[model samples]
Target chain A: MKKKVLLILLLLPLLSGCWDELYFKDLQIVTLVGIGGEKGDVTVHYSFPSVSGGNGVEYLTAKASGSSFSDARNNMNLKTGKVLDISQLQVLLLSDKSAEANIFDYLDSLYRTPRNRLSSHVALVKGELDAYMGNGKNENSGKTQDTPEFLTQLMDTIKEYSLSTDYNVQDMGSIMFAQGQDLALPLLKMSEESGQPELDGTALFNDFTYTGKSLDITESKMLNILQHNTGKFLRDTYIFEVQGREVPVTYEFIRSRKNWDIGETSITIRETIHVEIDEYSVTPVIGKGEFAELEKKLSAAIENDMQKTVESMQEAKSDAIGIGRRVRAFHHNLWEKGDWHDTFSELDIQVKVKVKVERTGILD
Target chain B: MKPVMAPVQMFLLLFLVQTGTFFINFPSLMIKAAGRDSWWLFFILGLLHFPHLWLFERFYRDFKWTKFISLLYGIYWFFAMVSITSYTVYTLNVYAFPKTPTVVVILLITLVLLSASTSKTSTSVNLGVLMLPLIGVFLIFLMMSINNLEWTNLFPVGHMTSKDLFRGFFAAQLPFGGMELYLLFRYLTAGKIGNAKLMIYSGIWLVFFMFMLILSLAFFSLKEFTMISEPIIYLLKSQEVTFAERLDLIFIYIWLAWSIISLCGIAFAIMRLMNIHRVKKPNYVAAFLCIPYIPLVWYTATKTGTELNGRILTYGHMVFAFILPLIVILFNRYKGRKEPAK
Candidate 1:
């Protein structure tokens, strides 16, 4: 009994949790961080929940500027009453100006800090970060859903709609460093009408820096399809010409299989998509032959649009489809030729999309 | 002394002692050395352990523990334990407790080692059995990172140069460092556990390592293998479970506990050696053995210390664990035993 008691006494100090023990009250959790400006001059916006006058918690946005992100964060720490902790940070917004610079440089501090969360959502914002991340009085400032929660939910909603790939801050490192593949982040712009941040398009990046080119929402959806990044609901409306009249056909994607055939200098990407017809306004008495003809027309239209999407990406010099990755793995001779971005821009790449309408909703 | 430990317990000891400290950084080293071809090299190197085990098993009965051989093993295990404890402290400081002093971390680890070393060898052997279920849980959680794996990263397999192959083989030696313990134990009776059982046990251990290697390779990009020092921890850090946000913290603590136990296993071996040499009060001697290591371990908590420790472990493992044992076995097999003490 004496030995047991002595052992307990010996272990009592260890139970105090030592020097790194951080109390919750001492830490002000910053849920959202916005980074802007170029390498030498950087600005960071930290948004944290603050308790006010016996009421519920209200979020407050604080801004700081310095030479680098760490410098800005350190400067911000001086202004805050409590230690500014980003361990629970939900989203990181990068401005267009910042995204134009080397992305890895902006993110290196976050990655190096062991306490920083890597699963946070990263998005590219249009214009200055100050406009999007206002003083948190969003309701009075003619803004709707400008909060970080809304932004994260918007990104999640887009992911469900198959408009963007589910690449977080951690996953971006893989794509950023990979020689064969490039990274495409979701682009956000404050809606002029709603004064809320909206999914503008997808930002195209060549190597580590932004290529100053982006694809619109429709084109971004197409890019997601080509990359096989289909989420739960991949619904799209396509214009089909039937009997000299253009009719809109809406389809929900079921499954897709992509096969890439690479030659010496040319590559052909063939995709077979199984879809369910959600909406077809013009209901012609379709037989099996007519249905086959419809499939052929749809395939040709999708193929043309997909080909245009590939051209746009190639023009931007962004291999977001990981075609270069496939080539590097299988075709070593071509991979060793030159820089992947340069080789990708010059390659003869073709897209062939085949759509098979498995179901035509409940009406059919 | 009679062999009190069961054959199963001894095998568990061997596996835990060889791999506990190694699993933290072995994947990164292997991937950095060989890239996509790391898994292939690991397979070949893992298979090579069988021949060495066979050689040890054949000559082990004839081999006798002399004062010189015992002293060499004692010194090697002592330094090995110190190095491993230092590395573990370094890891804990980086991930779990950034503000904790290296000496404090060393103190806590050495306290556990001191306790285990002062006890019977069976006490340390039984600790391995209790960890089996947790190891299974750890493995399943590691597999949860499969959702993040990019299967295409495993391609370009045959691109490793001769230099890379040589480096990969050298890096692969980290896990198999203390494998000479298989002969040292002698408690795993030859009658119950033959060559086949030993091979199967080793194969299971190798498969566990290969699974971790494959997950790490496919999970991170080739360039990331160079940047991230602890790919396994980062892999776990990137993963999110339903209940926990930071899975790496839980696993790191578990890994730290396993490391301490493995250190205890090493200390137990040194204690057994001392006791065999008829040293007075072997337990107290083993306890005193850890006192000097605190300062040494604290000094080696830096990056340079980490690199120095790595080189020592690699070369020391090659010379002391493999080459020396093989030479001693060969000498005993061909020329017969110089010191016939049993």
Candidate 2:
């Protein structure tokens, strides 16, 4: 037994490992995220735990790009004494200007780089992150957490928000890699009013560039339905006929599933959803058939909203729904011979929606 | 004859060793063949080996000795030399090409493998079993990767065309190349130890395990598996374990061990052939013969060692892995059931 123990111990060193090791303390961790801009310029900024290491007030700033991101990063070393390390980066902010121009070249380098993890969250900002990250203030300051603490929190939010589905680096690649599909990134607007844009909506795409069509939070609810991220809707929205009064109704999506019926001319997408009411500003008018009527009214509204989002995507020539990808998977031979992306937009999408009310949350 | 390795142990060791080089690049190869339908290609390739294995065993049972290589032509041997030479060269580059005396480093490895199997007595069968568990742990690690499988990624059924299916299915046999083990089995059996089902069982194990594990690796990646090169290692390079810097080190380790084992398996065949023919050279000379293939590989690619998974490796694998077995199976069947030819 002693000899066997010694043999195992001795054989271990001859086998593998200990060739190289990097400790976090010995190196500076870069939490900065950059995006490519026009004229081959890359916007650069990074953050680390401000002085004392553990203290949380971090520093983030940007530099204009005259070269690629790596070169700009090399140049940033001149401004700051520390070398830029991006292996620890957790979030990416692409200004609407950059994404509108096309993010493929920028994304390709990052995705191909050995150090990039492909799991980072990416957002399309409505304005310059430099204004806030450069100025450093709380009001209308666009902020994204690059630390593990908020990553788990965001992952939890992924369960609640279906719109957050195409909001990651992997999501961006999926959109770009798929045929005839315009890519959409979550668009956010920063203002002193809304507390630094938190996933304000989605930026639509044509080719790799943004089409400048963004859906607001309400429209994004239905966009989530089209993406089928929220598999079913457990809560319903309040229906109030206010005679031109904008009724505030919040629908909490629980589950949604879409089936695309490929017709000779138009594509029909039938969506079956499960939903329940969460809030409404008006009292319900109790009648014998009130519940059934409300169900029809809500389903109609949801279906109308979903159709609008899907059509917007179709018009943008974006394949974000991955319908073309679906065909490539199932009818691979036929798709190889044909123009998949063009055929997809010509697809007439007709939607039929179904909803089930679970409950009005605590009568409020 | 070398001591007989247990059929089960040989199955696991062959399954792990053959995959050591192939799986690291399987996702890309499969994707290229089947597009999104690569997993089905892996499954079908595993099944295709069954008929081929049956043909070899039937030929072995009648001949009562070793290989069909002697009956095959001198020019066919040119392709055979080309194929084996290329595979051996590629395998050597993976572990020790740039760092050492390129030829000398490969020769040392070839010697280590030859030393283990030169004995005709059933002694080093234990070595095959000993390496099984260590390699099995790697298999289990790949399976552990399945826990991260995304079912939605495999969305929309029947995605690959019948043509893509044919192409991808053929590509998967690169990992199944060690089916030459029938040659190994014939020597070890020395007589009838098990039935044809031994071959059947090994085939079934290889096909199913690769189907599930390779499929999961393809499906678990963030995007459509279209972007990955050297898919398996690229997948690892993407993974982080809260602390570990790069998971590819595990891949580097597996590649090294597998190269050693495969080189041993190839050497075992060569030495046994020299014995059957009554060649009077030392057994060690047969091992060194594969050494010349190393320089051939260096000429084919850069000496920088950065491109282990490049075109040269794939093409060489095709010549040896697909073409060689394909010819052996064809000629063995063509000879029409010889009576005690061995």
Candidate 3:
């Protein structure tokens, strides 16, 4: 009884004094980490909550010189007037050069720090990270286009094409560390025929450094569907083509059903893509063979696309679609005996696309 | 000495402690240590540790009269104290630099507040009561985080070798390693409790929590894993309650509570050691002893600290926690000695 009393007594003073408890209001929220890398130095930039009455954001830039990553972050606090806040940081972009050289050192610094949330989007840019980050005019005057806006935009753009799933931090780790495979990130390059830049497909990486291969828009869509994972993307797009028509029939991926068969040596994978066709037809030909012909042409086109992708992925020796990972999961022992990735590279891919044109919306 | 926790509590303890903190860097850290095929590495390492865990259990079983840790004092008290002190120091320090208020503030919090509180919980029942809140918060966080979890995350269901299975299991340990505190906790074993049952359930529960946390972590954000610092906390933050913008703030606070409670247990163990050694004013001695450790915590929180702490944790686990317990267990089992007192 005395011991219990003593124990409670012991905890009272300590528990009552909660020294580390800080509310949301107390913290200076940081929204992004913009890493601009040179030959020797790395500059980290983020927008914190500004004290100014009119504008809520306080932009801070910190540059640090270090032989290694930790030294740079240590030097970061010294450079910036405010403490480097990371809890709210939503995005980190690496310049093309630094990503190519190797991003492990810079990335290691973020991994070591606890203040930074791991859900922050990690990406590589075509040119410099700083060039795009804070320098741009604040497009949204009311709300600062800090880290969150860019992350949302990048993710939203990919959503339209039904791109990769969970482009967040944990997946990055799995890609980096998971067995028998390398991780890949979608790289968005800046292209402006207009004033604003748009995010493209993806950049591939072999564990640590960038592989310098960029998948164009369509290929990324193909990669997602082939992997049999769907996000906010519809796999099919179509343009109707009939015989004696000036333009040949064109169909984009709408939906797909795929199946796989594995033998002693090779695996035969087949994808049946359902394409959505959008066309205006005032006079419709009531021909039985015409629909069949459209199916064949569309199937052949999809097959051609699929074949090109498999060949490109094979040549690159990259498993962005995770076909190797899939084979490894289902056939563990057989996978171990063979160089699964090599096997994947040499896969006898059979694309059997079934393109169905829905005339429901067509004005035929 | 009797068993410290009931089967359920033991189970909760394992699940809570092991699973929380490791998510911050487990994937990347393990990758660097093992390789890109780290899931396989963990599978193998997990198998390796099973025997090690068994050996550890056997060691405590043989020396039934004394705790496994008490045996350490007999062999190398000086070295043991340094190891335990440094460990508690590193845990409070390194964790603080990244997650909480600041290194110095957490130091004062853990050392002055938490360690001081531990000085009172000398008995088994009292200690269990003290640890209950930690276990509770852990379960709460685990359940809440699991609520928003997506089943598809574990998908692309691929085959893993005995190698991948082993890596995943060993990787499970980072979240559930709290079972190791059993060495110090032997004093709390109640005679009526099912000992092996408690430990097994703890390990299993821990494994499940780890699998869920790791699966969600890996599934939702593969791209940001390396770039983002704390994956587990981020996982919690991803949850939308319509009330909180970020669940991590609450998550970190709860986690700090758990760590502080655990650290208090460890620090109290040190104070008790000082009392037995006939030291004058054990608290004063503990205070004086803690003076040198603060700088280390400060220095390490700064960046270079992570490497230093990592080497120490890896080596420390190997030398003291991993190898020491295994050798002791094997030796005792071979010698056919009576089991130790719980």
Which regions of candidate 3 are displaced past 4 Å? A1-38, A41-87, A122-124, A127-155, A160-166, A169-192, A204-213, A243-267, A272-299, A315-317, A326-350, A354-364, B1-85, B97-253, B260-342
lDDT of 1 by residue, B1-342 (tens): 456677777778888888797787889999999999999889988888777777676667665677898898888888888789888988899999989877777887887888877876668778887678889888888888876778888888898899999999989988888877766686333345578977887788789789888888888899998789898899888886678868889989989888887887788788878777789988778767767888889988776787689879889888876778777877876876643323
* Candidate 1: tens digits of C-alpha lDDT, residues A1-364: 9979979987997888679988989999888899997897889988877777775566678889888999999998888788888898888889987888898887888988888888888889998787666453456644323476677788789888977666788988889988689999888988877677888888989988889888877778778888888778888788888767988888888888999999889999999988888888777516646678778877887788788888988999998888988888889899988998999999999988888989888765
lDDT of each: 0.82, 0.56, 0.54
Shift in Å, residue A190, candidate 1: 1.1
Q: Candidate 2: list runs displaced more than 4 Å.
A: A1-20, A53-57, A60-66, A77-80, A132-135, A138-160, A231-251, A280-290, A327-343, A359-364, B33-46, B61-173, B190-199, B202-227, B236-264, B267-342
Q: Please provide, for model 2 over A1-364, each residue's C-alpha lDDT reduced to its tens digit, 9 standing for 90 to 100.
A: 9958855775575466433334666656665464647637776655554443554455645464546666677777777655566776766767778777767766666766655656666777777665434334544335432232332344335435564444456556655655534566666565556333455677777767887877665566676677665522323355556535656566676666678776556667888776656665554623456566656777888888778877777776666666665565455554565577566666778878886655666663
Q: Give the Å shift of residue A291 in candidate 1.
A: 2.6
True contacts kept of 1: 0.74
Comparing 1 and 3 on DockQ, the stronger one: 1
Better-scoring candidate (TM-score), 1 or 2:
1
The CAPRI category of model 1 is medium
Best by TM-score: 1
Ranking by TM-score: 1, 2, 3
List TM-scores for all candidates, in order: 0.96, 0.75, 0.62
